[model samples]
Target: MLNIQNTKLFWASCLALLVTSLSFGIRAGIMNQLGIDFQLSTSQLGTITAAAFWGFPLAIVVGGFVVDMIGMKRLLVMAFIFHLAGIVLTIFAQGYWSLFLSTLLIGIANGTVEAACNPLVAALYPENKTTRLNHFHLWFPGGIVIGTLLVTLFVQLGLGWKVQVAMMIIPTLIYGYLFSKLDFPVTERVSSGYSSSDMYKAVLSPLFIFMFICMFGTAITELFTGQWIGLLLKNVTDNAILLLTLTTGIMVIGRGFAEPVVHRLAPQGVLLLSAIFAAAGLYMLSTFTGNSIFFAAIIFGIGVCYFWPTMIGFVAENVPKSGALGLNLMGGAGMFAVSIYTMFMGNFYDNLIVKHLPAGASLSVYLKAPENSASAQALANAKNLAGPEILQATLIIPIILIVAFGGLVIYLRSRKKSRSVAL
Candidate 1:
């Protein structure tokens, strides 16, 4: 125990993240309705969904650089402003473009939460950096779980998804009140006397550069593949919907065990192990058959469970000089991965259709073809052929991560031995 008295602030940060998660779920639940109302295609709706992710890099990078200067309190206040405005805008959105802009604002607000509070948690619990960060991140998937239930409940009760979206305001306001009343401490970077230029330089440092590449691979492996779980497993098992839920559940429970793991293995050790499991699990997902599908999915779930938070923990722990900027860049890399790879995979899928399937193949995929549906049928066949390969391609990402993280572990061990000899 670090004798932490500011637990209220930590809980408030969780609340803020909870609100963000709720917005994410609510929007996803309502996408079909929004599409109907706007007469937008699924691809267009995907663009709306992407805005929530793509906006993260900009807000986090800028906020990370300035967060120490303004302090967590003001940075949180900025997040609150954007969150409030974005939520309100989303509620009143009339069409595709408006929804896009509103969600973009929400994405920025979401990134602000990560930028401000990750450092706050780090500064608050110096000895428990990995453990506390893991605990703090539980709210992300935890919030998603709760938000999904809220969306389902509201929809079941014949309430529109807006009602679920509106409910997030309660948590948002609660966090706002808690944060407004409290005083924030200085960031780890500031207390350590790292100047702005010093922090910026830390990001470009060779060690940080390696960590950046590792984070990029980690993000793509975990999230990029995750986005396509349903389509990838559509034919493998009938539990496609439950598959995502299962993965998220495993993540929440896995993080609960992070403290013990961090104590034993340390951050690099944990990442090295995580990469191994992730690589093995993705292989299982790409090739596993029979009753082993569930088994493989579980393995995959546990594999990625520790990745995102641990990566952040590693950067904050080892690259302390980079401060909030370091964590910011790390998170930025992940979000960028999600944004870019979604497009990349979509392109790959389309190319697969062009390469393998015939025109008008998708519309009559399983049923009789309506007139002028040859192109749609072609798309369906392409998805069938391409989706699995996209998933299998993700195995390459984790394989890269294994090598990168393995090297980091060796380097860390060498440095530790050298420090011991000097001592």
Candidate 2:
């Protein structure tokens, strides 16, 4: 189905995916570094990490609305600009607000990229949209692995975080050049003369609502881990950076094999399985108490591996020409939901940890002073009495979403069956 050797378009699709993947790594790794250097609390850190997702909802909404009108090339070019500007601002950012704004720009740019490219990939590979989309997403984890390795080395060698963020400019420019040269195909759905009113009507359809639910859960699954795993490790272990990379390593490996895996099970089956794995992993990680804690991350990575891109692929294959609007809404809604989830985690941590430090207590004292810190450390301390409670909340949210989305999938299948019966 790939036939990369025979088609530059195939290669271009891969390259575009690579560009976005590389872009995410630059932002995430550097954000982790910033959290440490700035002495930010988990809540403050969450805000920064979540900033990239803050603009996502709107970006998807607006990007989808304009994608067909503006064309893929223009939106992609705009995405490149937003990402580039975000990275540049991040390098120079001295305060939390600067970092937040910069990350927000990156979020917006990423939404634009998804809005443009998700549909483009489907249009280009109509018959194998799911597999190709899954394959295209391989670059995301691949880039994370590369970025993690490079950032680790750079940090160890005493290079500043600025250097790591500055490195993002390379892919942004290269991809911009390639996108400038590539020709994008128009999809059949958009090519038909469906009026603007009809296109808008599709956005309000039951199918679109079902897909949104999928996108939302999938977003929480992927971002909840990607954005928090590093912090989760630091809260539990000394080798946080290594642990972060290890989980992402598993994610890369999973995505590498996801094309064939998705092929065998198909998108819906893969999604159901992924949700189960993800729910179990989240519960386990949230309650982890031993050195075996690292295993939970691996499991979580495996569970979330096919989620984000597969959600995009599902939209592409099922909705096809929902056009740029469909792509933007999916990406935007996903990111926005994640940003909200991260913030929720942050607020809980802040109220429970940062706000109520006892008299004459330092952070270290509050963290380690057994009796005094016990309440504050409930979420952080794997052995704390309240840890399980917190973990249960995170696990339950996803479990519920999974059940809801699973029902939607079943309904769709039944509807199709009935249609066939009537025929």
Candidate 3:
């Protein structure tokens, strides 16, 4: 039976996460508008977006280290303040610096949510750490679906991007209220009587380090692509936002029912399979277009469905001594890598478009040309040509993960065999 107090805390954590992902989805939806309104280039927009990612690691890593000292409640309260400030600042943002600063604040809030809630959930349901964490994380994609659908609805109703962004405030306030009224518990590491020194030692272990490195691959494969999907697929489909919605929608359902898969494959086995599908799906997305892209999206969604939570779960189960610090560090590393990659991706995408443009035609010149004119057509062709190549470029990350996870699975099985033989 579920304990009433823990259940309430769990749902509040979910609501907090919902707020975090809603920001992501809304930002993805508004990227084009921000570019147009601010006279910003894709690279500039990516920098603003990258702020959210890079800032996340800063707060999460710091919160992880200090959460035990300051308490989860305090961290969450900080999240509430940051969320409100970030949202209001973003709604009023003027240009690059303002947008970057606001996004950085929101990213910090997002990280704070994870820093407190991940360990909270793990502590709340110690017996089912992996499965429960998957359930907890389902909200990441779930909130994206909500945010994207809201963006679609608001856009259709002739509402501006500012209005769409303001929608997040409703949930943010509710989560704040929910969190304030709750009584919090100590983290599992503390409850289990482990020392902070033990956590530090465990995080530096070879196994933990290996997983930390793998986090970069898994996170980039999942988040970077998700964030950029609208731009990447815009040339190929008018309903690009729907594709993001569809992809995350699949993730929602898959994660909701993740227990069976986790039980059957084990975490490492599941990761190996996820990496395989992610690589294949990403490559397929690069190659496919039009209605056929939906098929590719399904495969891609399935591949990344278990990645974030499962990676955390693996560390929690396998590296218990590392505690909240380990979980937060894993998440921090992933976001930090994505931060750097987002900038590179934006720059690479711009370069690709420039490479594909006709001789004597610059992107700015073509962009300002009359719609349906020869110059506009040239720009369209460039986007179409350049987009797929970018997706293909990202294919290498998942491919590397396939080998890494496969080795991990084999090594783990060998260790199990050795123990059984000795017994």
Best model per lDDT: 3
Candidate 1 local lDDT, 1-423, one digit each (tens): 234446878888888888876776566556546755676644565566668778877788888878877888988898898898888888888888889999899999998998898899998888788899999887776666676566567767998866667787788888888899988889988888888888878888998888887887887777665555654565556555355556667778988888988889898888888888888888887777667867777888788888889989988888788998899899998887777777666556555645666554442242233434875455555556665677788888888888888898999899999999999
Regarding TM-score, does 1 or 3 come out ahead? 3
Which residue pairs show collisions in model 2?
Answer: 64-325
> What's the lDDT for all of these models?
0.77, 0.71, 0.93
Model 2, range 1-423, lDDT digits (tens) per residue? 335422666565566566566556655666656755665666788888787787767676787777777777888888889988988898889888888898888878877777777777776777777776776777777777777677778878999888987877887888788778766666445775656776667767888878786777788777766655555556566665565577778877887677679888777778888888889888777778567778887887788888887877777667654655766688888888888888888768555544445444455434334443565464355323333444566777668767876886698789889999999
Model 3: clashing residue pairs?
Answer: none
In the order shown, what is each candidate's alpha-carbon RMSD? 3.5, 4.0, 1.2
Cα-based lDDT at residue 391, candidate 2: 54
lDDT of the structure predicted as candidate 2: 0.71
lDDT of 3 by residue, 195-239 (tens): 999999999999999999999999999999999999888889899
Better of 1 and 3 by lDDT: 3
TM-score of 1: 0.87
Q: Any runs in candidate 2 off by more than 4 Å, and if so which?
A: 1-13, 355-391
Model 3 ranges with Cα > 4 A deviation: 368-373
After superposition, the stretches of candidate 1 with alpha carbons farther than 4 Å from their true spots are 1-5, 26-43, 152-159, 231-239, 288-292, 353-357, 360-384
